[model samples]
Target: MVYSEQQIMAWASSFFWPLLRISAMFIAIPVFSGRFVDNKILVGAALMVTFFTLPLLPEHRAIDVLSHEGIMTGLQQLLIGLSVGFVLQLVFSAIIFAGQGIAYSMGLGFASMMDPTTGVSVPVVSQFYLVLATLLFLTLGGHLVLIEMLIDSFNTLPIGDIGMERSDIWSIIAWSSRIFSAGLLMALPAIVSLLMVNIAFGVVTRAAPQLNIFAVGFPITLILGTLLMWVTLTSVLGNFTNLLAESYGVIGDFLRIRR
Candidate 1:
C-alpha cells in the first residue's frame, strides 16, 4: 500500500505518544519499577500495554514527532503518568515511616536491613511493615487498578500541551505531608504504649538506682513492642486500605478522571 508522508507521520505519532506515557508510568510505578522486575521485561510489558491501549485512545492530531510541539506533548504525557505513580509511592513511604517510628520505640532502631524493593537500609520493623503492605497492595489488586486508571487518563487527560497545572502540582506536594501525618497515626498506638512503659521504667530506676535499668528494661521493651505490634497488626492493614483509597482519589483528581 502506498502511503503519503503525512499518513506515515500520523501513524508514528499516534504510537509514539501513547508509548511514552505507558513506558514512563511503568518506570515510575511501585511493583513494576522494583529491582526484582527486569528492565527488558518492563519495556516489553509497556510496549504490549501501549499496543492494546492504542485502540482505546482517542484519535490524535497529526504532528511531526521531531517537532517542538511534539516534544512538549510527550513531556505532558510523561508528567501525567509520573504524577499518578508518585502519589501512590508516597503511600508506601508513609508505611515505611510508621514502621521506623515503631522500631525506634521498641529499641530496635539498630536492627536495620536493606530493602530489596528500593535497595535502601531500613529498620527490621520497617521491613516487616513493607512486606505486609506489598502483600496487601497486590491482594487489593492495586496494580490492576493503577493500570486501569492510566488507560482512562488518555481519554480524560489526552495528549496535548495541556497537562498538570501549578495547582495540581501544589496539591501533590501538599498530599505528601500524609507521609508524616498518616504514619504518625499508624504508629501512635505503639508510640504511646512504649512511652508509658518507658515512664514506668524511669520511676523504677529512681526507686532503685543500683538495679541496672538498662539490662532489665531493654528485653522488656523489646517483648512489649513485639506484643503490641502483633496486637495492632490488623489495625495497620486497615489504615493501609484507607491510605490506598485516598491515594487513588488523589490520582483521579490529578488526572481529571471521574470517580
Candidate 2:
C-alpha cells in the first residue's frame, strides 16, 4: 500500500484529463447532453470510460494539478470536447430549423409544444422532425459512431494543451452556415409548393373580389401543406443521411486539422 507522491500524481493525471474531456462532451452532445440525463449518470459513464481507456492513453507528465499549466491543460481538453460535440449539434439544429420553416409555411406556427431537449416551446412540426431525426440517428448507429470518434480524437489530437488553431476556429465558423443552408434546402420543396398555392389564392381574390380569400384560402393552404409534408417525408430520410455523413466528415476534418 506504500506509494510515493509521484506515483499518485501520475495516476490522478491519467484519470483526470480523460474524464474532463469525456464529461465536457457529454455536456455538449445530444441525448446524453440533454437536461433529461442526470449529472450523476454522465459522471459515472465518464469515469467508467476513463478506466476502460486509461491503459491505451499515453503516459502522463507529472505536474501540479492546481498549478497554472494544469489549469490551462484542463481548459484545452474542454475546448477539444466542446468542438467535437458542437459539429454534431449543428446537424440536429438543421433539422429543427427546417421543421420550423415548414411549420410556418403550413400556417402551423401557432401549434407549439415544449421541446424536451431545449425546454422551449417550438412548433409541433419542429418537434416531429427532431424526434424523427433522433430515431433515424439512433437507427444508423450514430451514437456509437460518435463515441468511436470521441475515442479516436485522443489518438489524433493527443491529451495536451494544443487547442484549436485560428484556422480551425474559422473553419468551424464557416461550416456553421451549412446549418441554415441545409435546413432551407430541406424545407424548400414545401415552401415552394406553398408559395404557389398562395399565388393561386391571390389570383382568385383578384379575379373575384366577392370571394372571401381569408375564409377559403386558410383551409386550402393547410390541406395542401399537410399533403406536401407527407410527400416531402421521403426526401427527409435521404437528406438526413447526407447531412449526417457530412457532419461526421467535418468532425474528421476538424480533428485532422488539429493534427
Candidate 3:
C-alpha cells in the first residue's frame, strides 16, 4: 500500500491544523490554563480532542505543512481558538474585578494573597468570588459548551487564510469593556452599601470630633461590609450566568454559529 506524498500531506494537514486550534484553546481557557494543570495533561487532552474532531472536520486541501501558506493557516487557527477562549477569560477577569472592588470598599484591600490560577496577588474577597465562579463554570458545563463551539467553528470558519475579520477583532476589543462594566455591576450593591456606611461614619466623626473613627468605625465597617457581601452574594451567580450567556452570544457571532 503505497501512499503518495500528496496523500501523506493531506493526512498530516488534517491532524496538524485542528491540533493547532484545539491546543491553543486549551492554553487560553480558564481552569485548564491555570498552572495547577500540568502541561503534559493539556497536550494529551488537545491530542485526544483533535483525534475525535478530525472525523467531524470537512475534507482538507493538501497544503504543504512547511510552506508559507501553511504558516498563515496555522496562525489563523491559533487566533480563532485564542479569541474564543479570551472572551471567556474576560468574564472571569470581571469576576475578579468585582471582588477587588468589594474588598476595597470593605477596607480589606490589603488582605490579598497570590492567586494560583493567574499567579498574581488579589484580595481574599476576590479570590473567594473566583472560586465560586470557577465552580459555577464547571457545574454549568461551560467547558463542554466551549469545546462544542470550537468544533462548530471548523465548519463555519474553516482552516484557511480567511480567519477572524476586522469586525470580529473590533467586537472583541469592544467586549473587553465587560471586565469593567460587568465587574462594576456585580460590585455596585456592596460598594454603595459600604459608601453609605462610610458617610455615616463621617457624620459621626464630624458631630463628635473626639471619637476615633480609626478605632471605632473600622471594626464596624468591616462587620457591615461582611454582612452586605453575604446579602449580595446571592446575586453574584446570577450576574455571572448573564455574563456567560452574553459571552457565548459574542462567540457565536464571530464563529458564525447560530445560538
Candidate 4:
C-alpha cells in the first residue's frame, strides 16, 4: 500500500507529543535521569512508551505541528514533564538540607564528599540521609506513585494545550520554602541537644582558665548528637514521609484544573 503525505503526517503528529513527554522526563528525573544511564537506554524507554501511548492520545489531527501554534504545544508538554520531575527533586533535596543542618550543629561540616547522583559535593551526613531517603522512597513505592501521577496528567491536561496556570507556577515557589522549614524540623532534636552542650562548655571554659574546652567539647557534642538521633530517629522518618506526600499532592494540585 502506498502511503499518502496525509497518512505520514498523521503518524508523525501522533508520535511527537508522546515523545515530548518521555524525553523531557528522561532527562529531568533524578535517578533515571543520571548521566550514567546510557542514552540508548533512555531513548529505548521513550520509544517503547511512545509506541503504546500514540493510539490512546486524542487526535489534534487538525493542529499543524510545523507551524508556530504547534511549537507552543510542544513547549507545553515540556513544561508539564519538567514540573513533575522537579517536585520530586525538591523532596529529596529537603532531606539533604536537613542532614546538612544537623551536621553543622554537631561540628561535622568538614566531612563532605562528591555525590555521584547529583555531581556535587555534599556533606557525608547529608549524603547518608539522601541515600536513606532514596531507600525509603522506593520502599514506600513513591516512585510508582509519581509515575501514575505523570500518566494521569495526560488525562487532565492532554497534549497540545496550555498546561501551566499562573497559580501552578506559584505553587512550585511556595513548596520551595518548605525546604528550609523541613530542614529545621528534621535537625531540631540534635540542634537543641548540641546547644545545651555548647552552653555547658562555655561555663566550664570560664571556670577553668587553663583547661581547653575544645578538647572535650567536640567529643561531647558528637556523643550527644548520636544519642539524640537514636532517640528521635522515628520522628525524622515521619517528617520526611510527610514531605514526600506533600510533594506528590502539590504536583497533583498543580496539574488540576482551576475551579
| Tens digits of per-residue lDDT for model 3, 1-259 | 9999888888888899999999999999999999889999999999999998789988768777788998889889889999988999999999999999999998999999999889999999999999999999999999999999999998898887597899999999999999999999999999998999899999999999999899998898899889988898979879988999999999999999997
Model 2: runs farther than 4 Å from truth? 257-259
Model 4: per-residue Cα lDDT over 1-259, one tens digit each: 8998888877787788768876787667767676568889988987877787666666665456888988898888888888888877888788889888888888889989988778888888888887788788889988677766766677788776777888899879888989889988998887887888899889989999799888888898887777777777778888999998888789889778322
**lDDT (C-alpha) at residue 87 in model 1:** 89
Best of the two (2, 3) by TM-score:
3
Q: Score candidate 2 by lDDT.
A: 0.84
For lDDT, the strongest prediction is: 3
User: Model 1 over residues 69-164: C-alpha lDDT tens digits?
Assistant: 988887888888888878888999899999999999989999999987788999999999989999999998998899999999888887875877
lDDT of 4 at 155: 75
What lDDT would each prediction earn against the true structure? Answer: 0.90, 0.84, 0.92, 0.80
* TM value for model 1: 0.97
Task: Report the lDDT tens digits of candidate 2 across residue range 1-259.
Answer: 8999889998888889888888888788876777778889988887888788778776657666799888988887898788878888898889889999998987899999998887888899888988898899899999788777777777777766475677887888899998899999899999999989888888999999999998998888899888988999979767977998888888878676332
- Candidate 2 residue 183 C-alpha distance from true site, Å: 0.2
Off by over 4 Å in 1: none
Backbone clashes under 3 angstroms, per model: 0, 0, 0, 0
* Alpha-carbon RMSD to native, per candidate: 1.1, 1.8, 0.9, 2.2
Candidate 3 stretches greater than 4 Å from native: none
TM-score of model 2 vs. true structure:
0.94
